[model samples]
Target: MWRCALPPLHRYPTVDELAARAAALAVRSSGDVRLRRVGVSRAGTPLWLLSVGRGARQALVVAGPHANEPVGGATVLRLAERVLADPRLTAGADATWNLLLCLDPDGLRRNEGWLNGPYTLGRYFRHFFRPGFLEQPEWLPDGADGAALPETRALLRLQDELKPFFQCSLHGVDVGGAFVELTRDLPGLCRRVAHAAARLGIPLELGPYDTLYWPRLGPAVYRIPPPCPRDLAAAITEAAVESTWYHPQRHGTVTAVVEAPMWGVTAVADGSPPADRDGALRTVSHALRRDARVLERVLARVRPHLDGVPDAARLLAPVDDYLLVCPGLADAWDPDTADPLRPLPPLSTAHLTALRIAGGRIAVRTAGLLHQLVTRAGRDPAGALPELDALIDGWCAGYRDDCGARWIPVARQAEYQARVVLAAFHLAGARSGESDWGSQPVVPMHRE
Candidate 1:
């Protein structure tokens, strides 16, 4: 039987908050959930691992690699707790599971205030435009002379020591959809995972990143695309590809990668909520349970094939495209390309056409505001939140028309828009009455 004691939605834990919760839970269950500090993050934050059901062979699941996407971290921690709370479910599992719950502490912390802090609505808006990548501590590679970031070095050491049979690094795509990759064959397993996700009410759609969501149209909207494969590998860069499972097929240790949909804990019509707590928890909890069930079934079926997976020793021609997209951030958001987060300058004719290309309903006023904020955001986000939020609301309201052929499912899209709105609200709450920079007082910057 399920314990049913999980916290309500209002109390859903953020990445750091979950760490303390996981640590406490591990301590309480001393024999079941063993907590270990495997490494320190680039910011010297402890990278925690919670182990359950000890066995000879091991499997690893890591989350929070990028930080802002902390749902996977929270999900893994909850899964660990569930495992400890219910041993029979995880008992006799051929492989022991080692979960790295929150791989990117530095990135997680920077946005912590967005969920927990208090301020006026105005402050929250300005804070939303903060450039996460530029502030990401993990991306700062090793200095030429001698040293790598302590966190990076520690992770390398752990990989050498543990040599996990399977590795799953979890992250979220703002756009809705799901995708999975394995170095070699894991047919029955991937399909089973999809089946379980469907049972939990998540969409079964899987594809490359570009095909996952319809392209943007105007303010606060996206287009839904027809069925297609979204190249997720081509989306982000420097993401431990050399060390993940695909590394062999290309050159890495990560064996499997799965991209989950972008929905939040609750349901929202556009992006605002009824502010219901229990309802959201019930929905999300069911999803998590379903995910676990899927993973369990798939692992059982795939164990026999693990030994036969193509080894690094195989001689094969290098696939250029896979190699090009393996760099995590580079693949996701190319620095040289037009920044997705940044919009065109307000009132500019070119700005209108860009929004038109993105597709859906066209709102001249909303588009102009969002365009200005995104443009100014490239320079100063703290000054742009309020305007951003107003723009976001407009976009959210116009989602149906504005969403172009991007594949964001209707339900998940509402959830994502709500999360984005809440995120904007949090940023708007960062400060009160503002100081002067230009003629216009700074308003919330909502990207819609």
Candidate 2:
């Protein structure tokens, strides 16, 4: 009864359309799946949380804190539809399902252009919009008061109100294949999750993004590295992070971060040494460094163009500051630091790495936003805006030339993430029952 198939995702729905569709679905459904507006976005858009089934236990699944990551939105919709039609699909679930699709509507609205059609790299970057990391809902402040988005506050309240048994924060990437994050090492469950990802046809990002500095649990899944002690405060709302923010001592909660790429790179899926030796790892590291430089240069050029052009400074400055933090994302892959039997670092990949693709995506957005800034300046034939545009144009061209990625179907990625959610939920059921999924053949998950 576990349905992993997703609707066609060649195109995406606008925020308004997606919200309306969700609302309409709720209205038409009678018994189990009930939807309510949990909170409102700063832009006044309604944020709905759909509840399915009646049970004491609960599972919280959130998607799309970042507007550009629309794959999560697709995943949640399919899941809700599937669970509503057949509540038994949740078979042994002792919990209720609280599914939230697209928590950040204002940011998603800013990305409207690339949402509907043409899920291509160029179009996506051109219309991309993600807020600074500190401003994101998942990382909202817990201690010394700091600025927080309304969407963040809403989720915090929800997390506090209904501390669930499992949390699956669905996310997506653009460059590499797929990667996962779990709160701790549950090898059997990890394998189950990995197998579900394999069915989606994308390889695991052996060299994952963001884990370069953190400890990893397996080839593709990494442990949720701890933040400073301040993050554990009682008010930190759902653990201050989507993966580890549930309860005291994790209190019977399990979480996973499922990130899939838009493009399929052989290196991302492969675990063996490249024919060119460590060339692939180097290629990935070099890309990150190059991306950092591109972002720095783009930020410099766009700074001067922002005066009196209707929210230009407010829109661009924080993003500019955030880009500056990209350079230090990873340390150079030192073979000395690699595991003794492993040819590369524990998390290193052969061909395309997640950080490489992630860096390229970020650089493209930085350049694209700079171009937007220039365009907003009207006809500046003789000003710095035109010169800046010209520079960013070259970066954009170079980015496309470098990636040369074939955009995979979004539905495939969504299906994979959704299936992982299902896998995690099943794992939760097993956990509460105090058992494992028994033994199964380990799928040779990576090609090398």
Give each model's whole-structure lDDT. 0.40, 0.63
> Where does candidate 1 have its weakest 10-residue lDDT segment?
312-321
Instruction: State in Å the error of residue 25, model 1.
Output: 1.9
Candidate 1 structure quality by residue, lDDT tens digits, 200-234? 45543322323223343222122222222333342
Question: How good is model 2 by TM-score?
Answer: 0.81
**Judged by TM-score, which candidate is best?**
2
Off by over 4 Å in 2: 1-9, 89-92, 141-147, 229-251, 274-298, 330-347, 381-404, 434-448
Deviation (Å) of 164 in candidate 2: 0.4
The prediction achieving the highest lDDT against the true structure is 2
User: What is the C-alpha lDDT profile of model 2 across 189-236, one tens digit per residue?
Assistant: 568657866676676777664665456777677777655443322112
Compute the lDDT for candidate 2.
0.63
Model 2 weakest 10-residue run by lDDT: 439-448
